[model samples]
Target: MSPAETALPDLVDSHCHLDFPDLVGELPEVIARARAAGVGRMVTICTRLKNEPAVRAIAEAHAPVFYAAGTHPMSAAEEPLATVGELVALARHPKFVGIGETGLDYHYTAESRAIQQVSLRLHIEAAQETGLPLIIHSRDADQDMEAILAEGMARKPYACVMHCFSSGPRLAEAALEMGFTLSISGIAAFPKSQELRDIFLRTPLDRLVLETDSPYLAPPPHRGKRNEPAYVAHTARALAPLFGLSLPEFAARTTANFDRLFPRAAGAQQAA
Candidate 1:
């Protein structure tokens, strides 16, 4: 075996889209590659609730994969609003690990902002009710995101993670204040992400996790290529140094953070 692969530590890809077209066609090979890279577990997200069955099937078929489902912010206007009961019902499945890939994204669908807010709150309620962590996707809507999340916390506390977090320091601080985690994606490894790196540097290591957001942010050495769970190892290698730890140490720490956020997946690991 290659030296790096031989010594690879177990790592979790906290967020990814294994059900998406780019990765789904090659699911078995993609999953095998992820395991080969020491990405021992992956949480494949279903952005639109209608696709939950297919996403769940992917998880059911793969021992190392788990899934979460919700309506994405950009699609909030077009899709039926998800109910707390509906999301909670999905949580009955042993492999369902979280409540969303939901939140606001004003970058492209600003006109749907209001509906997005409603959708986010509904997901929050689901998270609150299920005791599952909320997996958020915020983009160019930090202020409202902060307010709404804080508002939810005021009504009732719940666990949450800002998935593929590339927001400003203020949002990061707000999330941390609410005891939420910030998931690092390949964007943090880009040459131009020093500012983002500094934000992560300032954040507590325990309050962070790693994700590929694959089929999207591919990190270095493969930045322009289609990303998969296997590439999350590249991101881990790139960010470990920032936290003053070796790859294995960083991997262990982030995996622990992911476990804390997604206990259901951790439970699966223990069973195996």
Candidate 2:
């Protein structure tokens, strides 16, 4: 391995869509490439409850892959709104570790705001009831997201991570204070994302995790190309210098952060 290649530690793609056609068509190859790049585990995120079977199948078919069950805000109208009991039943599977990829996304469409709020609350209630961590996706709706999250936390405490955070410092601080972790994606590696990088730089490493949001936001040198789990290493490499740590150190810390935030997965790892 080249020095840079060797520098990659056993990393985790905390969020990815392996169920999507782009990567699903070549599942074995995708997993192999990720393995070659030192990705020890990957969580194939579910964007719709309707696809829960496929998502669960992907995780069941792979040794180091797990899955989450939730509806994405963008697809809220497409699937039935999740209930705490329904989501809890779905999460009973061995590899299921989280309750959502659900939250507000006002950038795309404002027409679904009410539906989005209802859907998001369902996922949050499920997380609280089951004690499973939530994986949230918020975009251009930070105020609504924070209000809803704060309200949810007040009802009952549950762990959650803000996936692909590209929000302002206020939202970041609010989420952090609520004990929510922040996950940085390949977007943080973009040139115009210095503001995001600065926000991440200020956050504690223990509350920071890494992801690719794959088949989507590939980091530098791979920008505009279809991203994959292997590219998460690049995101980690970018964060290493920002955090003043070696690549291995950053990977280890983020991996630990991922594990701590998703205790069910950690328990599964120990049992395995």
lDDT of each: 0.93, 0.89
Q: Best lDDT goes to which candidate? A: 1
Q: Candidate 1 at 220: error in angstroms?
A: 0.9
Off by over 4 Å in 2: 1-8, 267-272
State the TM-score for model 1.
Answer: 0.96
lDDT of 2 by residue, 20-46 (tens): 988999998898888878788889998
Best model number under TM-score: 1
Evaluated against the true structure, the overall lDDT of model 1 is: 0.93
Residue 28 miss distance in model 1 (angstroms):
0.7
Residue range 28-75, candidate 1, lDDT tens digits: 899888888889999999999999999999999899999999999999
Off by over 4 Å in 1: 1-6, 270-272
For every candidate structure, what is the RMSD over all alpha carbons to the true structure, in angstroms?
2.0, 2.3
Q: After superposition, how far is residue 194 of candidate 1 from its true place, in Å?
A: 0.5
Residue 140 lDDT, candidate 2, scale 0-100: 91
What TM-score would candidate 2 get against the native? Answer: 0.95
